[model samples]
Target: MKVVAADSSSAILNEKFDPLTIVATAAVLVDSPYREARGSLPEPIYADANKGYEVIVHEAELCLNLLEKTKADVVHLDISLGAISLEELSPIQFTNMKISTLGKQHLLKILPRIRKIAGEITRKYGIEVLAIGKESIPVRIAELTSGANAILYACEKTLKENQPVLLGLPSKCQPRISDESAYLYSLMAAEHDVRGFAADQSGVLEKVHISEVLNPIARGFRALRIEPKT
Candidate 1:
């Protein structure tokens, strides 16, 4: 089945590698044998990292926006709530679920907005938006897609501000630059062919120097040091 999924990934990091802002959010359409995105819509939000839960709203909105341009059998969200139908999800449903206190509170705050968009997708397209989260391969693709695009956005930021920017990439992914595009390939086993890429049509990759380093405190996660070419 064709799947559309959305995720926000990558973040601007402080000197201690703490994330300061989320760098990009993306929605992607994936077909069978889904190892990569067939089509994608990516946006650079640069939103506060402490309010990460709010990004879910933007992710759902991105899924709806992508639906306007293409069709999918289902939509997957990064909510991780047992793949429940988001349209039918209610705040009361949280009582039975085994989620942390903070997680439940965050979901409660965003439920109205997410439910509104979920209802719209169902009524307008007759497809269910599942809170499948990371279990869905399509959602992973969306994460990598957003991470790849985040690199471009980070480079642009460094150049615009003429300073170095520390970027934390999604976990278990390695980045490569080729053909004027930046790609983040999933390093997880059995996902050798799965990758997400963003084109650098403005030649931004050439205008910056990027160095990859392992995040000291976050195992399996990597960071990039981006500096404008002098």
Candidate 2:
């Protein structure tokens, strides 16, 4: 069982992050030092007013295209597109939720096309998409009204369906906890869904950067890390 703890003086973002310059990306560093655990606190803690980590939301192909054209060393992704299809912003899910939604997101209808597009794009450019998200437990990556099956099944349809390349990703833990390492962790997690990425240090979350109401986990790669322009 994991717990969300709050601490100001020793939060990782405060201690490790460069407060003066904006935190653009993080690298995985390892030492014998382990993160110190703080006392368990209640949920929805809003002591800090920071907007949490800034995230960029765009289609998967758009992201990949950016990566290739720039030839940048690293790219970060957060799956949270923000209630993509939902009408009510107050109760948005899956980043792109739309109006009058009731059941699971239409994964079956969209997944195939989305995967096909990604496959075609990947094939043409060999662009690598970095997958990031919380360690979800039966959590739908996004909301679905009907296309859920195809969205998931699209995995098999793609050429990289079961390739060794598919079993790679940076890390498996929540994004903010390992703020500095999220980028590296994400790279490994992209390779392996269950790789269980390791971090150099353990630290607490400051309410300043993390909002009380945001679903950091449900946000996916869109909500996980920064978009570095290289």
Candidate 3:
């Protein structure tokens, strides 16, 4: 008994390898990378200055979604909820509220299916569908999401700047992580409690305000934000 106890003690003292931490690898599908580019690097939809892969989705192009080329834990839709003006946009100055209204309605009709596809994809791949867009897109997504945070993304700058004048949205961000990956993962986690995003590289991110993203959209766009259901 004494000899065995001594041997056990020596083994414990001679342990070499360090402890291992639990790690999770996640993949996200982004349809469009055109909207938010900061310098040469594509600014992730959500990322933390202090950590890794909070949100990393490649540009999820809508044209290829039908082909099943991408699978994501969470998808950042590329479809803009606002409309493209047929009323001679070149002549119309300032914001086109009327045209935007038409766009939102179209977005509304399209989203239920988007929700369905999001749900279907999440079920098939065991992931979550995140309904994100400039300003109004999230609102429409939230309407379908039923008091869920499924509707979230960086807001447009005009709304952020004119928040006091024209606060179009009803609810706040609902205490969700604003970082793109965190936002994406949270929605995914809401569905299946997944673990991580794929952007694990060092120095893969930069910082900017959410309001900054919204600014360009309000100015004008031929932009689109897709719903999985659509």
Query: Listing every candidate in turn, what is its Cα RMSD in Å to the true structure after a full C-alpha superposition?
Result: 0.8, 19.2, 22.9
Per-residue lDDT tens digits of candidate 3, residues 107-220?
Answer: 444444554555555555554443333332222222222111112222232233332111111122222223343222122223232111222132111232222112232332
Residue 179, model 3, lDDT: 35
Q: Which 10 successive residues of model 2 have the least lDDT summed? A: 138-147
Instruction: Judge candidate 3 against the unseen true structure and give its global Cα lDDT, from 0 to 1.
Output: 0.25
Question: What lDDT score is found at residue 46 in candidate 3?
Answer: 25
Better of 1 and 3 by lDDT: 1
The C-alpha lDDT values of all candidates are: 0.95, 0.24, 0.25
Model 1 C-alpha lDDT versus the unseen true structure: 0.95
Q: What is the per-residue lDDT of model 2 for residues 180-207, given as tens digits with 9 covering 90 to 100?
A: 3221112224432321122223221111
Model 3: how far residue 194 lies from native, Å = 27
Report how far off residue 141 is in candidate 2 (Å).
Answer: 18
Q: At residue 60, what lDDT does model 2 achieve?
A: 40
Backbone clash count, each prediction separately = 0, 55, 29
Off by over 4 Å in 1: none
**Model 3: lowest-lDDT 10 consecutive positions:** 1-10
